[model samples]
Target: MKDTAKHQGLRNQLVSLLEQKGITDKNVLEAIKKIPRHLFLNSSFEDYAYQDKAFPIGAGQTISQPYTVAFQSQLLEVKKEHKILEIGTGSGYQTAVLCAMGAKVYTVERQIELFKKTSVLFRKLGIRPKYFASGDGYKGLELHAPYDSILVTAGAPIIPKPLMAQLKIGGRLVIPLGEDVQIMTLLIRKNETQFEKHEFGEFRFVPLLEDKN
Candidate 1:
């Protein structure tokens, strides 16, 4: 994918907008500035990539809005080499952002088509997550348990218990919880059984799909 100076300029503008909108995490903003968001979408929609909007990526999924990505990333308080489990790989844009910040990300995608497509894109962009699995988001990857942070990119009706259980004590889980319009919820693991909950404003996202088979 060709990332021209114009595209970089657009990303700079987007980062400024994110900052004005209260995304103060410098690393998060830097990742936003560095990643070529346009390369994550189909070439035909390249013009719309840098805007703070979601666009269809196929298999009934949309890449998350830039602000949403930044908000979730900032909430996670990602540290370099932190282990992160991401639900809903989608367009792989979120995965790339986590990777950019030096987190070892293990991402799950329920839609095989999107999973495969995004895997190819990650390779092309030279963005490598720690692991990629085509599986259920609700069933967080237990093989690599106790992540420092977990992020769910889709709208969930409830906090997936498996995801909550997988977090290390003091770990953060960022999810959009609802069926129609999601309330951005942050759950920080307080102990083996208790979690501290906080809510941000409302956001719209594609439903988190469960495997039928």
Candidate 2:
């Protein structure tokens, strides 16, 4: 649970690498810098936490690579106090980033072990998301509909209709869509029935599963 000066130095290097890879949003970068990513991984993986790579965090899921987190966060254009819904709260790394940027995050995770473990981690780190639930993300959190932005951290075979319907008008939903290798996609809700779509290359993630554990 220690975030040493050495860990901070490593994060600085990682942020520089992210900048070189075209992550231009300062807010995202700052959030990435502030969060102690090493604490989110198993102790054995702490040394590699700042390497811009994904690591398994039990339950057959992996914390997303740093670049993917930055890219998806940038696409959402998150603002202070934005009501954000995040699917797949794997290690709570993404949720912490959103919270650090001042978004009121409502995140859901299907893996029970991760959901419970990360819930504790959030409290220990003082990263207060609006809500965190153990559930099937494909359904979206309908109880809290109309989000300012939605971010899906895992690969999905299709854009889940429930998630699309939950977005506020002009809100963005950033997701990685595909089976094997996912395409990073952004969908902006134009109105009740229309969305503007864009794609930004490929990323691989653990598949977004259907039911709760």
Candidate 3:
């Protein structure tokens, strides 16, 4: 009973926060509220879960802030049956959001420890994604090719070609680009020959490195 009440309070606060930040998608807001962000953190930091800041989860990685996760998820423009590819699983908060939105998520985490940790947490949270891979190969999840949307949480100097190839025609890719600082970018496939690109704004994220563990 106490646990349910805590979750409800957190949900309400998160919904209010999302609204203040202009996250208009009701589905997205509901997903954010439904997923328990505290489950992704260590017990000591669980109390801070409702706060809207990135918190460290070891391995030099941080669970992305609620706004960033919501912002990225919104940019993906996921459909009810969209097959989504996530480049960095991190703490799996973003993946949870995508799954909650009714998308089939294929997520890859480069760190084995974080990957395994998040996998167990996902089971506990009951936010099952379509695929979860732990290891170095994060170019893209090609086995399940032609995803409707691809979201890269890590900021990369250049978008990985494999990820671009995995997108079906008319699919969308949202990633953060540049070094030192980053800008969130949205790319839409306009047939095989070209892509339409849009820059969202300045953002800060951990550099997306090729960690082949």
Top-scoring candidate (TM-score): 1
Q: lDDT tens digits, residues 1-213, model 1?
A: 788999999999999999999999999999999999998888888989988999999999999999999999999999999999999999999999999999999999999899889988888889899999899998999999989999999999999899989999999999999999999999999999899999999999999988778
Q: Which residue pairs of candidate 1 clash?
A: none
TM-score, cand. 3: 0.94
Error of 3 at 2 (Å): 7.8
Total clashing pairs in model 1: 0
Per-model lDDT: 0.94, 0.94, 0.86
What would the per-residue lDDT of candidate 3 be over residues 98-133, giving only the tens digit for each residue? 988999999888888898888888887777899999
TM-score of each candidate?
0.99, 0.98, 0.94
Candidates in order: C-alpha RMSD to true structure = 0.7, 1.0, 1.7
Displacement of the residue 173 alpha carbon in candidate 1, Å: 0.4
- Whose TM-score is higher: candidate 2's or candidate 3's? 2
lDDT tens digits, residue span 1-213, model 2: 788999999999999999999999999999999999999999999878999899999999998889999999999999999999999999999999999999999999998899999999998998899989999999999999999999999999999999999999999999999999999999999999999999999899999999844
Compute the lDDT of residue 205 as modeled in candidate 3: 87
